[model samples]
Target: MTDTAPSESTAPQHDALLADLTTIRVGGPAHTLLRPATEQELIVTMRDVWQRGDEWLLIGGGSNMVISDEGFDGTVIHIATRGIQLVSQTDTTLSLRVQAGESWDGLVAKLVSRGWAGLEALSGIPGSVGAAPIQNIGAYGQEVASVLDGIDFLDYDNSEFVHLTTAELELGYRNSVIKEGRAGVVLAVYFTLTASPESTVQYQQLATALGVNIGDGVPVQQVRDTVLALRASKAMVLDPNEPDSASCGSFFTNPIVPEHIARALPADAPRWVVDDEPVADVVVPLGETPAPPPPPKPRLVKLSAAWLIENSGVNKGFRLPGSRAAVSTKHSLAIVNRTGADAAEIAELARYIGACVLSRYGIHLQPEPVAVGVELA
Candidate 1:
């Protein structure tokens, strides 16, 4: 491979390059945006970025990030570096290592047809595989962490690339250390997926939405299709026509609060708390009181973030500062770029919305997308 080493006097144009990166079509130009084609290129690019002592952001599919319109004042390394190789597969399980730059939907679809079960439920997510574990990507009923075996990350502190186990990754609900952007850059990921006839439908919403159940043995293809359908309806899937899906999926990590908070609400409210622990999430009804509460269950009670956003009084198309950006008209949770918006406009809009929720509901809405060259408003 040839070298992409920037000279002492030359750097990639930050202006023309800024328009080329990101899903929202916002963000300012980078001092340099490196599109590495292979692992070697990725390494060299990263070394260049770090050695320059300039702030850097690694972009994948560009689906889950919102950058500031002010433009990144430092280097932006675009991981166009891509590939996927299946290491081995038995009659009931498949072990494959995927490059970080490959499209996630494409990867999941390819494996589903081959009868791989672990990733089928994660089919419609829009980022690269490298970012998958960083956020512990999940949908329907499964998180990528379940089938995940390991990851290859550039250990910046060590100045060397390293492999990490699922345990070491410390995966949680849509969170990982790498997703926090501490591991430098993710190059590839490994998964040990089930090829067996059995699949778990742990998410009750998924089963009810699809009209299926666990132990019923559904095909991987059916599950994938159903998940995509449901997500698309909610504007969670990227729909070029609908600005709502253009956002990072579900803007908040469902609040996991203490069981006491759940109990504080009226008995008719939909409250579910961890049975054995003090933690729980009471699914606050949307715009009205719920009919009746579901029975309490063990473990963390999963509540909907969207419900909270709507009840918080910030509706879709909520505008501020001349309408360059606003909440999507179809979905209350997504902050959308409208009418030639820039990164700063979106950042300010997010800040206003987040502040409103925190002030009124006491819920701090953590953004789902990674912010590049921008701080949460």
Candidate 2:
């Protein structure tokens, strides 16, 4: 597609505060803001910004982003396109192609209502479908990677639209190629879901809430309701009435460390094995039989960030003496804008919590949200 500038009649919003768009409500004004309401408009607007060589930013649901108080100095394109099409279906399974701008939780709700199981455990996640693959968003022991089939991507380098398979996306623990500096935009996401009425309860907390044991099966709707309840209790779900929900859900991701590093932490620290080295298959001559592979090495352990923060002497609801930013009273992982706090204050709280965790555990905590014109240092 050819790149062209938007007409004067279609000029973007000028001096729009990013705080109005983002969930955290802490950023300054954007020099220019464009809300593309369709796939074609989104592509055209992005191409125009690129061709003009103007600095640009893309926002979806704006749930997982933190912008500086000084604000963005360039164009901010908000993805507002929405649609959900059934790509294919069988008696037992179905593939869905969802627009990038579709609300993630909304989609889960619809899927559960239809008795399509797969993403019930991810209910109450606040963000757009496009942001899901970028963050590999997950909760209650189920990740986007588990059901993702592929994505229709717009490559920034060539301005070409291409399809990327799940393997090509390289989704990992809250990470993917798009998050790893790959310059591209996800236009749509593909997911394969089952037409099952029940889903397996894998997370301990979720199971306990549902009065079931881990590995037990429960109705998909029940799982969604229970997961939503769990998220609301932690203040992870976005609710206008809940002041604590004004912050980004889980500001810090659980850190995955090598087995030895995890061993150094206190025995009481919550951790789970996330990955392990795979044993390579032995090769032998055509006439000879291959011997068995060696045992796998110690696996990588994922440590709980909330536990690390609390144990580091930074308790829930803790805040700087003069700052309006504070740790969420309901969950230590989140830093909330207690009252009209600026981006700097929020960043300060995050840095302090990270430093405290590093000092106590010797493992640095990584911020989960995308920081724009803001430094955690």
Off by over 4 Å in 1: 1-13, 17-19, 266-302
Q: Stretches of candidate 2 above 4 Å error?
A: 1-10, 277-298
Tell me, by lDDT, which candidate is best.
2
Overall lDDT per candidate, in order of appearance: 0.74, 0.91
In model 2, which residue pairs have backbone atoms overlapping below 3 Å?
A: none
| Per-model TM-score on C-alpha atoms | 0.85, 0.94
lDDT per residue as tens, model 2, 45-155: 877788898998989999998999999999998887899999999999989999999999999999999999999999999989999999999989799999999999989
Question: Looking at candidate 2, what is the lDDT of residue 169?
Answer: 94
Q: How many steric clashes does model 1 contain? A: 5
> What is candidate 1's lDDT per residue for 1-377, written digit by digit as tens?
34565443233545545534666677777766666667777877677667767787778888778876666777777776678888897887788899988889989988888777888878788878888889898876688888899998887776577889999899888888776556578889999988754456667777886687754667778888888887777677777777665565665566666665555434543444534654455676589876576666645554556666666678877789576777877777777765777777777878887888777667677887777768764
Pairing residues by index, what is the TM-score of model 1? 0.85
Q: Clashes in model 1: which pairs? A: 28-71, 68-343, 69-343, 69-344, 351-377
